[model samples]
Target: MQKTFKLLLVILTYFSASSCDDLFEYHPNQIRLDSDERNLTATNLERLQKQQPGDTLRLIVMGDTQRFYDDAVDFVKSANSRFQDIDFVIHQGDISDFGMTQEHKWVQDILKDLKWPYLTVVGNHDLLANGSKVYQQMYGPLNYSFTYGHTKFVMVDTNGREYSFNGKVPDINWLAKELAPQQGEVWQQAIVVSHVPPYDADFDRKLEASYHHALAQSNMVSLSLFGHIHNWNTDYLYDNKILYHGTTTVKNRGFTYLKVWEGGYDIRRIAY
Candidate 1:
């Protein structure tokens, strides 16, 4: 009887430890990550710079990976099947469906297997609970830019409704500044990326006019990329001044292929 009791106690202790390791959360806003997982946007940008993109930049744009683990795995495989032909990947957002850090980590684990580097924008679903905080810790700023090849890719956060239309989202002032040429920056064209497009109702309706005007003001700015729509779409909106490329969600097993050069660009949808 004594020996049996000791053995049972040992088994219970082991299981308790395992459970804690798997599901323990010290705080709802806690962010736990490995070194390689943190600041992924910055890391991937460094890798891209080293590759030295030519006059044309080829990319695989996809998003809305939230709660779609199986599909996400298949996406990496499909994306890798044509690995060498691609330069880098752009994940439009919704890395976590529930806006949990663990979910973000799981998604990153899958994405890390890709042959090329990748970047992400923050999605609306990612704003749930402490998701926004976790996203910043894991992926750097909500808005950032990287100059590559002959174009400057400006990533912005346009999920204004999530902020209750705070009147500051999609920051036209910042967009205008980033779109313009600076002393140290080098790029002939500007490409904006975000999770939500301004035409969508979820976007700040009040800023739609100003948003379109800002893009138009920068005559060099023509193409903007988005992913919240869950459908592959491209349009010449803003009175045919700017071209928008909206990509599909991962659950649909689809993405958009973009090849942009100095003067013009091309777009194609891929159903993987």
Candidate 2:
């Protein structure tokens, strides 16, 4: 009987130690990650490029997973169950709550289970602590553009408040160049995806007009997608043709689905 009790005690101790290791982290800001977790943007983009182009591009846009790991898990299941035709998924930013590398990893673990390849934008929270480096390491550049089918998707960093309004964020100049028409490419539309919208208070006030004007003037720009407000909103702030769509966070259990063809697109909000 004593031998049996000793064995049970040892098993209990081992389980307790394992639980502590999982529950408590050494440092929230530590940049520890496995090989499979690194360079996710480039890896996913490679997967995206391998797929054949379709007449209409279907995508899932969601963001602000933040600290909601459980919700993110449910989100992946819901997305996978509903979106078989989606070419890719775009996370509009704030993948982590405190910009902790661990949080980013937690969210990525769930997002990787998604059926389609996924990409992310840099958010204000994602710039906190050593998150900027971690983000660049885990993901790719803060600002990037890719063309698939008849559309060009531009993902930019627009978290001006995080930069303390240094006036360089949103990188209007780079955006202008990205939005410029490429020679010999018959691009029918452009969509700008960012964490903060130009009209938001977090956006650089000085660059707001320029940013809006840039999108308005760009003939190819059809829509802009954002997430930070934690709610769903759509409007034509400048009263022009460019439409801005802001999405709710995964914590709220919602996302946006976009279907685009050569000249037009449709958007539907899904709450799951």
Best by lDDT: 2
Q: Model 1, which residues run further than 4 Å from truth?
A: 1-23, 27-29
Which pairs of residues clash in candidate 1, taking residues 3 or more apart in a chain or in different chains? none
Best by TM-score: 1
lDDT of each: 0.89, 0.90
What does candidate 1's lDDT look like per residue over 87-173, in tens digits?
889999988888988888889999999999999999999988988888888999998988887898899999999899999998999
C-alpha RMSD values across all candidates: 2.1, 3.2
Cα miss at 212, model 2 (Å)? 1.0
Residue ranges of candidate 2 with Cα displaced over 4 Å = 1-26
* Tens digit of per-residue lDDT, candidate 2, span 9-94: 99889878775636667887777777889989999999999998799999999999998889889999999997789999999999
Candidate 2 overall Cα lDDT vs. reference? 0.90
